[model samples]
Target: MTRRVLLALLLLGLAAGLVGAAAWAYEAWRDRVLEEGDRRGEARVQARWDEDRARAQEAALDKARQDAAETLRRLNQQQENERAQQALLAQLARDRDAARAAADGLRLRAAAYLDAAGCGHLAGDSALGCVREAAAEIGIALSRSAQIAQRVAADADEARSRGLRCEADYDALTLRLSML
Candidate 1:
C-alpha cells in the first residue's frame, strides 16, 4: 500500500507540473497578443494623425492661394483706375484749350463785324441789315460756348459719380468747332 500511495503522489505532482507549464505558456502567448494589438492600435492612430495633418496643410495652401489672387485683382483694379483718370484729365485739358480758341475766334469775328458796321450813310437798309446779321452771328457763337461749357461740367459730374475717369472728347470738340 505504501508503494501504491507513493506512485499516486508522483503521478499527481507530474500532472500539476504539466498544468503549470501549460498555463505559463498560455500567459506568455496572451501577453504577446496584447502587445501586438497595442502596436496595431498605435499605428492606426498615427495614420489618422498623418491624414489630418495633410488635410490641414491642404486647407492652408488653398487659403493662401485665394488670398494672393484677391490681392492681385485689387492691384489690377487700382492700375486700371489710374489709367482711366489720366485719360479723363487729358480730355479735359484739350477741351479747355479748344474752348479758349473758340472764344478768341469769336472775338476776331466781332472785330470784323464792327469794322463793317462803321460805314454810316451807305444805305440805311443795308447798314441796318448788316448790323442785325452780325448780332445774330454773335449770339449764336455765345450760345454755343455756353452749351459746350455746360456739357463739360455735366461730364465731370458724371465721372465723379460713377468713379470713372473717361470723357467724351468728340462731343465737346463738335460744339467748339461749330462756334468757329
Candidate 2:
C-alpha cells in the first residue's frame, strides 16, 4: 500500500505540469493573433489616406489644364484680331493715297486750264477781256473749294478709322471678361 500511494502522487504532479504548459501556449497564440489584427487595421487606414491625397492631386491637375487651355484660346483670338485690324488699316492707307493722287491730278488740270485761258494778259479792259477774267476767277474758286472738300473728307476718314479701332478694342475686352 505504501508503494501504490507514492506512484499515485507522482502521476498527479505530472498531470498538473502538462495542464500548465498547454495554458501558457494558448495565451501566447492569442497575443500573436491580436497583434496581427492591429497591424492590418493600421495598414488599411494608411492606404485610405494615400488614396485621398492622390485624388486631390488629380483634381488640381485637371483644373490647371483647363485654365491653361482657356488662356491659350484667348491669346489666339487676340492675335487674330490684331491681324485683321492691321489689314484694315493698310487698306485704308492705300485708299487714302489713291484719293490724294486723284486730287493732285485735278489740281494740275485746273492749273493747265488757267494757263490756257490767259486771263493774266488782259489787254485794254474790253467786255470780252472782262468775261475771260471772270471765267478764270471762277475756275480758281472751284479749285480752292475742291481742296477744302478733300481736306474735310480726309479728316472724316481719319475719325472713322479711329472709331473703328476703339470699338474693336472694346469688343476684345468684353470677350475676355465673358470668358472669365
What is the number of backbone collisions in each predicted candidate, taken in the order shown? 0, 0
Model 2 bad stretches (over 4 Å): 1-35, 120-180
lDDT of each: 0.71, 0.74
Instruction: Residues 1-180, candidate 1: write the lDDT tens digits.
Output: 999899999989999999999999999999999999999999999999999999999999998997686666556656676676677667766776687677767766765666576623343587676876666677677867767875876577556734552233333224344654
In angstroms, how far off is 44's CA in candidate 1? 2.4
Q: Number of the top candidate by TM-score?
A: 1
Count: clashes, candidate 2: 0
Q: What is the lDDT of candidate 1?
A: 0.71
- Candidate 2 at 51: error in angstroms? 2.2
lDDT of 2 at 21: 84
Q: TM-score for all predictions?
A: 0.62, 0.56
